[model samples]
Target: MVVLKKKEMMQCYTFFLLIIVVVASAIPTKADDQKKRVKEKSLSDASHSEDGEHNNDYDHEAFLGKEERQTFDQLSPEESRDRLGKIFEKIDKNSDGFVSEDELKDWIQYVQKRYITTDTERMWKDYDISDTNEITWNAYMKRTYGYGDAGEPKEGDPVYEYRDMITRDKRRWERADGNNDDKLNKEEFSNFLHPEDAEHMREIVVLETLEDIDKDKDGFISVEEYIGDMLSDQKKGEPEPDWVVNERKQFTDYRDKNKDGKMDKHEVMDWIIPTDYDHSSAESKHLIYESDKDKDGRLTKQEILDKHDLFVGSQATDFGEALTRHDEF
Candidate 1:
């Protein structure tokens, strides 16, 4: 047995404490996992920032559809006008020679649908290990979670978060399987992956949001909870970024309408999935507002072509969906 004097023992203890700190620092924190979790925002949230700077890329992507985003960006002014002309014909579905709010809304929805369709096909390749038209829930579970049945790892285990995620995926999968055949077709899988974009899956999206931010499991999100979720990267005693501060204000002032110091299910629904606030509809109005030079309620082909820069990419074209599509516009 080794014996040490008091000072020597203290030095050994200090060395072990330093090693412990290094190991602890190497482990990823809960905040990191929280940040990686689903905080996916809607189109409206993506289009505008906290500082009110309109991100034209998001609007353009929404306007032109994800597939056409790069096509429009790299286009010359003349080329932009040419493509806009073709898209205009599509938007003016009734052959009315004018784009109404409803027509524009329909077009935007179509673009989003196209995005979902394309994205699902790309993602499906990885999950369809059986090389079939549909994916079974068991296959998904095995592929994603490395197990056919997620038998709850103890909470705080490294994989406990994955168990929670698997549970969420299963709930979403069931919702996606409208036919309840225990499998998902492409469309159903699209809805599963992008419940945020689907109308019928609104409740699941809201429920998931509540589950994520409602730390106390009180079925409501308090101000602290909202701020905490947004500031997942923030450490204790660290100062919040300006955007987080602005979001805190937005939550209190605009989000919590009843002023109960917290948000109930209804309030959360309004905040996340407001009945009146349709992303497609809002973008439609905004499109007309920006491009309708005639001051009329509808947009003419000439008007859209004139504002081709607004509708498509003028300056940069290598982001979002553009970079991935290797072929030219």
Candidate 2:
């Protein structure tokens, strides 16, 4: 029961979960192509429905990231539209009458950056107890894994996963330590937390990916291992779904380039780090695709104002605020 309770708490606070290894894998078995496909349709950077309905909350998040979305949610419909109109002008980037793709993409990136800043500050307070403007490796480990009477699980304990997670966090933390001092200042801590957002930390992201899906400990991914990762969620007695079967074919036909029958390091890199998928660009294109009237391929101020409800007009979309009011684990 205690283990189950910890698992539940971990899921809720999993945004900074690279350290919580057992609770979350740093990468997916594969980047969820289904969600990626759905993202292209709705303005969602995450997942959505097949029919591409106007997912208001998702669009809001894609345009303004998680934290900003919560802030926007506080606005009344009239106030929301007025504020969105001001934001749209800034997104236009030039004095041009329309918002070009580049302009929209840049704005989305800015919104995401703002969210990352807030997230880093919020989490920084938890680890930087000494207020020395740095989060030491020992400080982080002590705060996260904990100490004293069985606070941390031991080698043979039922929750032994923490041991492996501690090792993994140390590797990542070291990589983020650009100064080589074994301590992460504020900037380094952000890189440590969200490596995906940092260009330099791409290798760490890939290393974590390989460590995650390369489960055979043989240093490569076989087609069976690739398929098996997906089946982690499959029920005990159920037959493999058609999509699962199709994925097996995808591995041989598309994923396993060079006809090697197994994914080498480069192959795994190519598979996960797709070149074409840009979350900001995808959301921008989809937003323009749906809301752009007169088929102009770009949004005019009035066109966006007309579709204000589709963007920030979400009310019941409040996420986890009430839940967060409780004492976190």
Candidate 3:
């Protein structure tokens, strides 16, 4: 048995306490680190809460008119086949069995025009309440945000149905108002709605898109940030979901073209907008690829009907709407 005097025991206790303090100071507490991360995320989210508009890289619903969207959804596969056959007939203006590259290009242009015209008319009716063929800032705010006579939204008033839209449109209004007149003519309004149509406006759209996804404010998107934006509901400190894991792999493999472990502006733009190709042309090429059974460069009516499933689903045959509808797209 060993026994120590009081003074000796007191000195030993002090030495033990010093060692405990040193170790405690060396390691960071998990809870503190988590709290700090949460605080940073909260501040970042608050700063960009109003800037919630996102370009749907994979869908086209924004381009479709309401009636067209509904009508397309209601189509059966057989009806889709008939409708597509008619559309092909229209494109095959010469009554030839096959559609040429020029004819396909023209049809693609017409489809683009149809979407723009429909969406423009709908937005015009909503914002141009005075039928003056222009939208003032006041008109835009009142219609979009549901502001009262005082020119501000009431404190207890219900949030606008499209609150994010109000923020996005306001920003666009400022940008599209080239003369800084605080008003938008029909042409300016069209540019705001479809910035991709205006070559100059495309840059703004690309920048905004990048900012929306770049969570850390580092001017680039890491694999984790890319997955986080794509899967917003994913919780911190939880096991990464399969989709997130797969997307991380994809980011490294494809999106991070420079192999830099992060995606820069050019890479992000390529992922989102895909350079050297228009959506309409892409859709046209997809259709031709699916239906051109004889390996010809063009599609024949018989070939399209034979592979009608590729054109129209059994639940909804109106695949044309898929060209502009995000879900089907």
Candidate 4:
């Protein structure tokens, strides 16, 4: 009788354990469903659509929509070419007209000046591959565009066709880097500059990016106009004047290892690379890619210093706030 009772107790314990496990497993699924529902609702709110009709806005454009094309018009010819080359190469990974995000990972890294200002920092945050912890090319493009098909509203549109010239220049840049060191030399910069065909291709991409952001039928992107459109969350009453208030908390957290209000741009850039400063000549720790400077196989401290002004210029969109926040960053 004692043995039989012990066996019955064991069975009951096993039954209870099974019930607990089943309940635990179900909670996550339920939570996930709720989270998805919430996300869907948020999208609907952002697009001002009912029944999630607005999600289709992303469907028509590969990277930017009609609303986004206007922003790139202000870029100079060089900036336009570099930026557009990246966009074209993003979608044409195989150097083919069509591509998926997976293939673009092997594409060569494009080196521009390191960002010392907030605008470039923001752009890098949105587009830079290493910072986002995503390795694939599609992920990089998606990070920049936030949607697909800037030219077409749906798949199979000729507007979805990728540019051939941009893809070639991107490939050429990658090929020139040879050793795959992230930075390029004076020779590499010259190669990109001297390419007669690259100029035309850059214009196409730069114009496209500008058109993506250039709203209000204006030829140029004024600070007020650019900031109003990019930063405004129509859902959240009036646009945010600057990103400072929004990122104020996070920036504060990262500021002042030395307890000063200022963050040294180089120090901040280094921190963005690997953990703490690892300045030993080890290849792994070097984060800044100085691809365009003199042929020394390295970017100088002065080059790193210029990033500050670019970032500041990009971020300080309003004159009043620009003046106030000039020294703050």
Candidate 5:
């Protein structure tokens, strides 16, 4: 059996959560084709019924909970600025004039934990039919697959509607059974819903990313492969964006450590999970760059309010929402 030290396990969890945040906030591109296909399938199911009976009530597009969906809607500039100011104040814990790296990191972890806890509780309630505070694989599959105790889906069942969920959750169950006990305790269930909390799951994600980007199937990502998604024009034959050109240069110059022409697994892993990386520091610098007007490397509450537009729709701008929905988590 493979054994991970406690500190190593914590690092894996942190690295996994950081990747989740980055991927969540990243600008969508053609490289997300697989995700796009899944999304498109859900949308298609929502719009049309195979049996010709329109089931528009099924909201296949809903990813967020009721409150989260409400909060995700756009706000006017004035309202957004007001909201941003409150957010900055909360993150600047200790009533400090500037947010420190520790403060920023704490805020990020808080947000991520809130999301995971909310999602996990929701799933637990759904599968825990006996109110026993634990879920067996049988109960989970029955609820998710919409099957009865007889071990099969009923006739006239909308099996197709849940095919994706079934497939995804079945794999999740296998991975979540960490002790191979065929059941998930509350903690394990949480890890099941949010795999970033499970250290072993991170390797799977890294491998998937490698497979997705290694276009030539040579076990490494070339410079072209690294920037392929960014370089591709959404409108055929159009020139790539200037930012894409800069990114291509960045990958070759900075990311290609040791002057290697290709990014091997270790190089890719470093690029994704840099050693001693502090997400808080990076986020703080970005906030200061956008809001600081005095050429200082810090932000005052007023300065944040003044340049709130820059932070809108960003993770830093929604502290209030995270707090307001705190009880749900």
Candidate 6:
């Protein structure tokens, strides 16, 4: 009878041992399944990111790229805008709302950015007007564009619908080139801000746009390597200098006024034409009022075109006289 009891106890112990083993083996399998699920979810998230639907916030530091972050940090936005403005105004002819596509190309070349030939594919995507490989002011001021003017938002604006400085810029661009001209050719534009004014304005804008790219301590930008860099997702050098970074931030106050991403012409100009704003000649202003039959203080396309030749001839004469004076001096 004792032997029989011992055998029964052994069987009970055996069953318990088997149960323990099964539980132990099941625990590992369950844990592994959980881990696999988590890993698969992580992979799915990564795939979603690669599809480009992610809404990552603007990372200016990362945008600066490894090579330029050091220099970009050194200069302020004010200095950058000041420098770029000088270059832009110098090349801009019509003092109009926008720079012509050709002028912009020249500027890119001047800054050492990659150059796309006039006839290259999508070359005119930035400015093409008639599908004839030409650019027009109307096209330049496309309301849908980030830089295009869509007019101003008045007081008591809605929370989401309030227009900002980009809107103003678009409106300014449209108003400046009202004639639907293909481009602001050299003769059509002039500087609203002359040497001193242009200098101040340029400093303000350049600092904001091209800050910290000056690897060399020299005031002027040595190269325009940031075009490609800006388009990538890379970490730049150490933090930019306080002054240089400050200028960039300050320029953003104006360039990105209203919290929009780009600038338009309205923010750049005032209604008063400069006394020195010689549209071909110093005498052109005299004809401005004469042409405004409606007396609204603005010249129409026909009116400006009517005297275009006269203005051209007067300017030529003035240029000659100035040359003669310089020779005499």
Tell me the whole-model lDDT of each prediction, alpha carbons only. 0.63, 0.58, 0.51, 0.28, 0.49, 0.27
Q: List TM-score per model, in order.
A: 0.73, 0.70, 0.64, 0.20, 0.58, 0.20
Candidate 2 lDDT over residue span 151-174, tens digit each: 345777543554555556677788
Give the residue spans of candidate 5 off by over 4 A.
1-33, 36-85, 95-101, 138-175, 215-218, 229-238, 254-261, 292-298, 313-329
Tens digit of lDDT per residue, candidate 6, span 1-329? Answer: 00111111122111100001111211123222111111110001111111223211101111111111223323344443333334335435575633443443343233211111211222334334464544454444352332233234445533113243224323333333325453532212111001111223332223322223333434433212222212223347645333333334433553344444333333222111122332222112334443445565544444433433221212222111111112212
Q: Candidate 4, which ten residues in sequence have the lowest lDDT sum?
A: 13-22
lDDT of 1 by residue, 94-150 (tens): 998999989999988776666666667776876766766888987776665555654
| Greater-TM-score candidate between 5 and 6 | 5
Candidate 6 has an lDDT of 0.27
Off by over 4 Å in 6: 1-123, 131-162, 171-329
Position 144, candidate 3: lDDT? 43
How well does candidate 1 match the true structure, expressed as C-alpha RMSD? 13.8
- The per-residue C-alpha lDDT of model 2 at residue 95 equals 67
Error of model 5, residue 298, in angstroms: 5.1
The Cα error of candidate 4 at residue 24, in Å, is: 39
Q: What is the lDDT of residue 237 in candidate 5?
A: 79
Worst 10 residues of 3 by lDDT: 13-22
> What TM-score does model 2 achieve against the real structure?
0.70
lDDT of 3 by residue, 57-155 (tens): 111221222223334556666666676677667778788789866676576566555655666677776677666677888766566444523233334
Model 3 CA deviation exceeding 4 Å by range: 1-78, 148-168, 234-246, 257-259, 316-329
Better of 1 and 5 by TM-score: 1
Clashes per candidate, residues 3 or more apart or on different chains = 1, 0, 0, 33, 0, 34
Which candidate gets the maximum TM-score versus the true structure? 1
